[model samples]
Target: MGDYLKKACCLLFALTTLAAASPVFAADVLHIQPKQHDCGLVDEGVPATMTAVVENVSGRDVHVSSVKTN
Candidate 1:
């Protein structure tokens, strides 16, 4: 029925969103190498926090998004 289809779609969306938002796995570190600099300039260190997206697709938990460094 139409109502059933609607409910199914809503459930699917909710599940997908939840999976996308959830942090099922985490990395030990999110570091970005700083560019080399001269004696006068300063170099910034690696990032402390970063954002990542995890997805549960095909019933398998996987990291689907690109790794980002802050």
Candidate 2:
């Protein structure tokens, strides 16, 4: 019984850790504006801009090197 409880606790911890490491966790940590949506149409020589909002929950300065689009 004791060993079973220990195994269950370990499994729970592992699952929690995996969830925390997934993209869902990052989405919760950072909020990006202009939420991704399918591009309906496109043409050449057209210009567009996108922005991402990131929160610094760590209270430390963070640097963003670059941003790209497909």
Candidate 3:
């Protein structure tokens, strides 16, 4: 019983310390430079291309599974 109480106290102390010392992180946001697209006389069946610069300024690398444009 004494050992269990000691272990529980230690665990609680460790968790509290971690919660207080750790830094909080915010959600990442996507920034699109051109926010607009203009297809000037392009064929409907032809493929159009655009340059994109995607970055994560949220102090972490974001994993992207898929992207779709409509």
Question: Number of the top candidate by lDDT?
Answer: 2
Which residue pairs in model 2 clash with each other?
none
Q: For residues 1-70, write the lDDT of model 3, one tens digit per residue.
A: 9999999999999999888766342122443344455555667798876545555545545676776888
TM-score top scorer = 2
lDDT of 1: 0.54
**CA RMSD, predictions in order:** 11.7, 8.4, 10.6
Model 2 scores a C-alpha lDDT of: 0.66
Q: For residues 3-45, what per-residue lDDT tens digits would candidate 2 score against the true structure?
A: 9999999999999889878977556554444534454455678
Cα-based lDDT for every prediction: 0.54, 0.66, 0.64
Q: Tens-digit lDDT track for model 1 on 1-70? A: 9999999999999999888766543432232343443334344884344333333334434443654434
All candidates in order of lDDT, best leading: 2, 3, 1
* Each prediction's number of clashing residue pairs: 0, 0, 0
